[model samples]
Target: MTTRYIDAGVNLTSSQFDDARDDIVMRAKQAGVDNMLLIGTNTQDSMHCLQLARHYGFVCTSGIHPHDAKSTQADYIAQLKTLFLHPEVVAVGECGLDFNRNFSPRSEQISVLSQQLELAEQNNLPVYLHERDAFDAMRAQLEQVKVHGVLHCFTGDKHALDFYLHYGLMIGITGWVCDERRGAQLQQLVPLIPDDRLLIETDAPYLLPRTLKPKPKSRRNEPAFVEAIVREVARLRGQSCEHVAKISHANFQRLFITRRGTQ
Candidate 1:
């Protein structure tokens, strides 16, 4: 049987996709990735993601990303709530703290993240999180709420991984695992994530797997490349690619689709 996959996160709304969106989705399906969670960083992007999800029969997220936290309007929560009314919007993020760039003030990031967490809890929806150099703040915020979701594109160390796992969030690994040097740590940590909590994403238009041969000249990542990520993850965990693909597909369903009574 052919192995199938679900790319747990994808920025399908990115301008980088431009006119090739249809081809991109087709290529992903041809490569065995049948479903994807389109990430939304703000109200406008969230709506675009939802439209794409509806058109392509995929799920998506609805929340503001930390980088945009500073510009979040006074009624941003209201906007998110409106987006959540659509079942295609499964999780509450692409949202979290990013002290690494600090494009938004630390205070704004915290406040916006806290509000989104509350929205997730109130709606009983899982959160699709992003964190970079802000694990401590992320952990502190998570402690105050009962939210569950994937920490998309996780690159943190064992301590962060342990806390997220214990807190009941799924782990999302990306093409970063395919890099020999920068990915060294992630490769070592891949085996530690439990099967039930493991998810894989492309974070497309970014993080192209360095291991891909005949690399695309544009260097733009896409959902189809999730196959490479799965294979690498399988190798790291000493398991078959089919097993990793199956479990990640199942995990995505459980966290986003199944719980929402959609597939």
Candidate 2:
């Protein structure tokens, strides 16, 4: 039987997909990726993501990303709150710290992330977090609030992985795990994540798995290619692709769908 999969995160709103969104979704469906979670990096983008989710019958997130944190409007949280009222808007982020790039002032990133965490807590919605080279700060902020969500595109070390798992957030593994050099550390750490806490994502149009055979000419990753990430994850974890696909799908359901008390 074919192994079915759910792409835990996808950036369908990226301008690269402007002329090919329909084809992209269809190709993913054909590849056995039946569902996806569209990511929104800001309020306007979140609205666009919601529209795409509605159009495609997929779920999405709504929040400002750390890079864009400094530019957030005064009513950003209120805007996110309104977006959450829609069942399609299942999580409250793409928000977190990125000390690696320092695209936004660290202080502003922390402030914005704190407010979004509070918003997630208030609505009882899970978050779709992002962190990079700021694990200590992220951990400190997380301790101050009660929230649950996936640490999307995780690339931290064992200490960071251990803390997130213990804190009860899901671990989202992306195609970064497919890179032999940069992913070497992550490859070693993949098997450490417990089954229930694992999730697979493409983070499409970004981290395309280097393991893909006959690599696409455009080098553009999409939901369909998530299978490559899953296969790599399964291989590292000593499990079948089917097992990883099943548990990740279940994890996604629990974290996003089931928690909403909807079908």
Candidate 3:
């Protein structure tokens, strides 16, 4: 039997899909990607993602990204509260820290992340976290709050992976795992994630899998390519693609759906 997939993260609101959104989603479905979680990086984008989710019967997340942390207004949490009322908004982020670029000041990123964590705890929503070269600070903030979510597109070291797992986060793997060079560490670490705590994503329009054969003419990633990540993860873990798919799908459903079954 063929394994079906659920994309844990997709930036379907990206301008790259401007005239091709419908086709992109259709292709994803044809490729066995039956569901996806649209990611919203800011309030306006979150609204756009929510609209798309409603239109397509997909789930979505709403929050300020670390890159946009400085732009977080005092009323940002209020804005998120409104977004959360919609049934399609399943998580509280795309929010976390990125010291690599530090587009936003470190202080601002922490402040915005803390507020989002508060929103998650208050509303009983899981978070969709992001961290880039800022794990120390991110871990500090996480320790202060009780929030649960996937660490989306994780490409960190074993230490970071263990920390998140110990903290009870489901790990999200992407095409980065398919990169022979940059993904070397991830390849070695794939088996470390237990079956029940692993999730898969494309982070579409980005992180195109380097292992994709007969690659598309354009470099833009999409939900359909998520299968490649699943395949690689399965290969590294010495499991069947079917097993990985089922486990990841179950993990996704449990984290984003079952936990909120009461809502």
Candidate 4:
């Protein structure tokens, strides 16, 4: 029997998908990934993601990623509110700090993230969070705001993982767990995520699972490969793939769909 899975995150609007969108979704369905949440990094892409979600019958988020913080307009929050009003745009982020790259200045990243958190609270929407080498700063902001959602594509140490878990966020595991190298820390942290708080994502067009057999020539990840992430997470946590898939799907619904009164 095949386990129906939901990819908690996917960047379907990326140019890599171009004209292959329909085929990508079909392949994901065939691979047992029956649903996916397309990510929105900025306002434009958030709108695009919502369109794709509605057209393809998936869910999506609306917010500005910290990397794009510098490009924010004065009415960004208002824009996000408008997007959030759409049934298809279920969360308020892909918004958080990323000191690792610091594409946007640290101050700008923090300011923008705080604004998004305020929007999430005001709109009563869950958030789709991200953080990299900025747990201290992210934790500080989280201390001031209370919201629900998944910490997408998590790749932090147990210390950071424990904090997020305690703070009431679902942990989103990705292909990083399949890496035999840098994924070592994340692999060790996997078993600690409670089943109810676990989620899975491909972060597709990125982080292709190293364990995937007959890897794609383009090396660009897609929603169809999320099953590989599920299998690896299952193995690392000593759980059955079906069990992991089922729970992750349930968790996604609890966080995104059920709250909105639909699946």
Candidate 5:
């Protein structure tokens, strides 16, 4: 039998993904996916994320995107915490710092990240981190946070990978693995991440694996394409597709189970 999978990271706020609950669930169900984690990019997106998950019986995780770090505030943190109390709201981030875009000020980014990290710590929830071109600073902030979570779409080097794993963080690989141009290191690092500490996602509507179905009009990504990511992992690890399916599913469950009570 095909193993049930998980669409571990999806930005569901795009109009393309709006009102897509039934379609998303059906596609995942057809793919033997047991659950999907709809990641939110901000406060409004977070609430929409929860409503969608609860309405569709899917699991969800939400927080501010690092690019929006400058927008973070005390009231926002409090509001996010209130949302965290909801049964389907698992995990406290998509939070962390993003220097690649630096759409926001760096000092503000650090301040907001520190505050959000504290919220995750206090809430006793795992985080869904997003880091880009700021691994060292991100690592520093992460080190200070006691809560655990995934380094989503990890593009770091060996030292960074080892550091995250050592600190009890999982590695979330996305469709980038299928992009030879941007993901060469990931191809080499996939096998290095322990089976129990690795997960896959489409980070949909963004990093569509060139191998997946008909491309969406606006670079919109769907849940089904996650299969390509799984396939890449299978090839990189020299494991059968079924084995990759089972192991990754298990790893995903183990990591998220701690937050199951929230949902």
Candidate 6:
């Protein structure tokens, strides 16, 4: 069987990322993932992501993770602009708000998110947003910009899901969906996500699924593990994994790879 997979959210800067390319890609092949969208949590991470993508011929995104929001500055945007110049850097963020941690002050989060949104707008780059326990604040921030991307690693309930649906934003689901305890809700809820608006990811170096057989020694996640997410989503939706793959592949193409080189 032929598999065309997109590991939509992964960390190329992780220690695991230093594993040789052939080893990394081989493991991904084991999980049936052929394509990857590596996440860059900062300017440095994003550069490494783009460079690795070029080397591996994998798709990638320039991710400015919400955790770094406090330190985000004008120079950050300048650095991001340079990263976006690479065709492999398909999106402008992993950027958004996370009230759950409150690691960064709300003001700093708002300021940085605002600047990143404007950066996405001005550069015409698609966005990859991250939100946790701050749905209302995130929605308010998004209200000011036209979105051209997804709310990645989505874990919200129906209302939050519906709000993004109205905004015409796509979603990227991760291994968190397979958690029998916390993810039980998603088992029912994920199917509600329209086919066109759905996609799958690993969020590697994080969110490892329990179903994984003989877990890694350190238990760090990787792109190869994304198949567990895809399979679990299919089970929840009562559809074949192949069907899920086809639709998500189409969604990825639509969102990141423009048709006929046009938007």
Per-residue lDDT, model 2, residue 64, is 95
Candidate 3 overall lDDT versus native: 0.93
Separate clash counts for every candidate: 0, 0, 0, 1, 3, 0
| Per-model root-mean-square deviation over C-alphas | 1.1, 1.0, 0.8, 1.2, 2.0, 1.8
In candidate 6, which residue ranges exceed 4 Å CA deviation?
19-22, 259-263
Quote the lDDT for 68 in model 2: 97
Residues 1-263, candidate 4, lDDT per residue (tens digit)? 87899999999999999979999999999988877899999999999999999999999999999999999999999898898778888898899999999999999999999999988887779999999999999999999989888898899888898899999999999999999999998888999999999999999999999999989998989999988988999999899999999999999988898897752
lDDT of 4 at 219: 90
| lDDT for residue 91 in candidate 1, whole number 0-100 | 94
Tell how far residue 91 is off in model 4, in angstroms: 0.4
- Encode model 1's per-residue lDDT on 110-176: one tens digit a residue: 9999999999998899999999999999999999999989999999999999999999999999999
The lDDT-based order of candidates, best leading, equals 2, 1, 3, 4, 6, 5
User: Which structure is stronger by TM-score: 1 or 6?
Assistant: 1
Q: Which runs of model 2 end up more than 4 angstroms from their true locations?
A: none
Off by over 4 Å in 1: none
- What TM-score do all the candidates reach, one by one? 0.98, 0.98, 0.98, 0.98, 0.93, 0.94
Instruction: Please list the C-alpha lDDT of all candidates, in the order they appear.
Output: 0.94, 0.95, 0.93, 0.92, 0.81, 0.83
Candidate 2 lDDT by residue in tens digits, 133-192: 999999999999989999999999999999999999999999999999999999999999
Q: Give the TM-score of candidate 6.
A: 0.94
Better of 4 and 5 by lDDT: 4
The residue-level lDDT of candidate 6 at 95 comes to: 89
Best by lDDT: 2
Pairs with backbone N, CA or C atoms under 3 Å apart (clashes), candidate 2:
none
- Return the clash pairs for model 3, or none: none
